[model samples]
Target: MTRHGKNCTAGAVYTYHEKKKDTAASGYGTQNIRLSRDAVKDFDCCCLSLQPCHDPVVTPDGYLYEREAILEYILHQKKEIARQMQAYEKQRGARREEQKELQRAAAQDHVRGFLEKEAAIVSRPLNPFTPKAASAGNGPGAVTRDSLSNATPCAVLRPSGAVVTLECVEKLIRKDMVDPVTGEKLTDRDIIVLQRGGTGFAGSGVKLQAEKSRPVMQA
Candidate 1:
């Protein structure tokens, strides 16, 4: 019988009771991984595979993963993380470019407002007949300020990439936040603290504005 208790490096930690009646359904192997009502949520699941672990291994961050699945992830997923990050940065760069154009319009609006107020001082732009109002896209400050908005979800942790699920954040917070794929350790500095939205949702705590996402390991 599989033993149920806290995790250790030596043996399988079974969180749910089972009679070894598993079929080869999940494609991992023919191991009994059926979940029982007594199983604890999140506490008994694999971090990487998000499935019940037959051969559980605990990381330094105290997260559980299936031995074979995590080992495979550690070996091959490093490149996957890199690919994901490259794609994410590419998209973010494009968004920043768009934001710059929007910022130019905003700066023009500001200048228009200023001109309205200083009608007596200068009725027109300092061209041949008007003034040369600042270009919004030309200023570094404008680019910095306008690049970020509520529409942008913080992408500081690229390991999660577009898949910013709750499980993703959980793996990020505890311990040193190891990415099994890259064997990289992420600090809080790597995270872009999110601003609260109208929905009062952000990454202030573990609970993020991100949608829900998922499971286990043994001896």
Candidate 2:
């Protein structure tokens, strides 16, 4: 009889334990004997077969997101992009309007300064009865109260042919409270103060106006 849990080294021949009346079926050259359930139960050894893990975690489809959820997410992203685009467009429009207003104010200031200068020069008290003096006062201020013929241009004025710059106009505008839309309010200050011979326009403050605009789209 071969004992269970016995460590054996065989030289040539080996034999397994034969139960009663079973040697006939275990005969011949070599026999592979399978253990009976009763014999396997009688053995005091652990026989644990490792079973393959088959816990199912099946996905809905071939993709991670379902079709409807993916569509909804895409729509939401598009809406967000559209909202951003709309906001950018509004900002661009506002900036353009500001630039146009600035340019317009600058142009108006330049024209007004030129006209004033011309008026002063034409209004100068001429030598009576001289054809040359009469011909000299033939520019834009031929018939204005503050004629250009009597006065020299302001020191800040540029040469006759050069384009008038916006820097001086901007300085003057900041020093005074003026409406940028219309040139009518250029000298709206109640009092003018002189400090070291430089004129300063004095007033309460810049006026505030409220206007309605389209609301920016939210994300």
Candidate 3:
């Protein structure tokens, strides 16, 4: 007996419909749609509403959008951006404080090390007549060096939220550190040095991409 039926022989060709096609069930898993010539493609739809626009507007980057829908989208976007910026500034200030602490610790360590070395030198016995003359100063080969960093990377001004580089801060030296935009009075302590990574382009990419990356900032 063959596998098809007990009556069928091994050489017999078995060709019969095992399952009938159902209009509802068979077609459920497949779709082949054809758009009419008059149909509007997705590109012609409003970017914000995803519908054919009555009052269309084109953004600077050439995306089509409905006027009212786009305006509302922009308003919400501006609010979201402002909130994100505030959070960023708060986090940035915290990090700035941490960096300042690190630098202060380094400076204290350097001073402590110098003092330890000075104490060791003074405790050692030395000939009293060996080094009083100006010509007896240590030669250039002594090669004394300091490890503390004196250069400021960048500076952030508070109250007005302005950030300036070290070079600009240097120009303000021997004078008042005033806010360039608001012309508000500033002090030396107001110039907080900044430290951050280069993530501006990456952030922009996340903001501009499709649904996959859109929620990063909003989240």
lDDT of each: 0.54, 0.42, 0.59
Model 2 score (lDDT): 0.42
Cα lDDT over the full model 3: 0.59
Instruction: Please give the range of 10 consecutive residues that has the lowest summed lDDT in model 1.
Output: 137-146
lDDT (C-alpha) at residue 211 in model 2? 80
Give the TM-score of each candidate.
0.23, 0.27, 0.36
**Residues 58-166, model 1: lDDT tens digits:** 9898989899988888778888998999999999999999999999999999999998888857454221111123355321111122233344433334343221323
Error of 3 at 69 (Å): 1.1
Collision pairs in model 3: none
Best by TM-score: 3
lDDT (Cα, tens digit) per residue for candidate 2, span 193-216: 211222232332323345889989
In terms of TM-score, which candidate is stronger, 1 or 3?
3
For candidate 3, write residues 1-219 as lDDT tens digits.
Answer: 446676434436544321223433576544445678655458779876779899999978998989999889889999999999999999999999999999999999999999999888756432121111224342111111111122324455653555455566676531665666567787766666555433445642224344554545553
Decreasing lDDT order of the candidates: 3, 1, 2
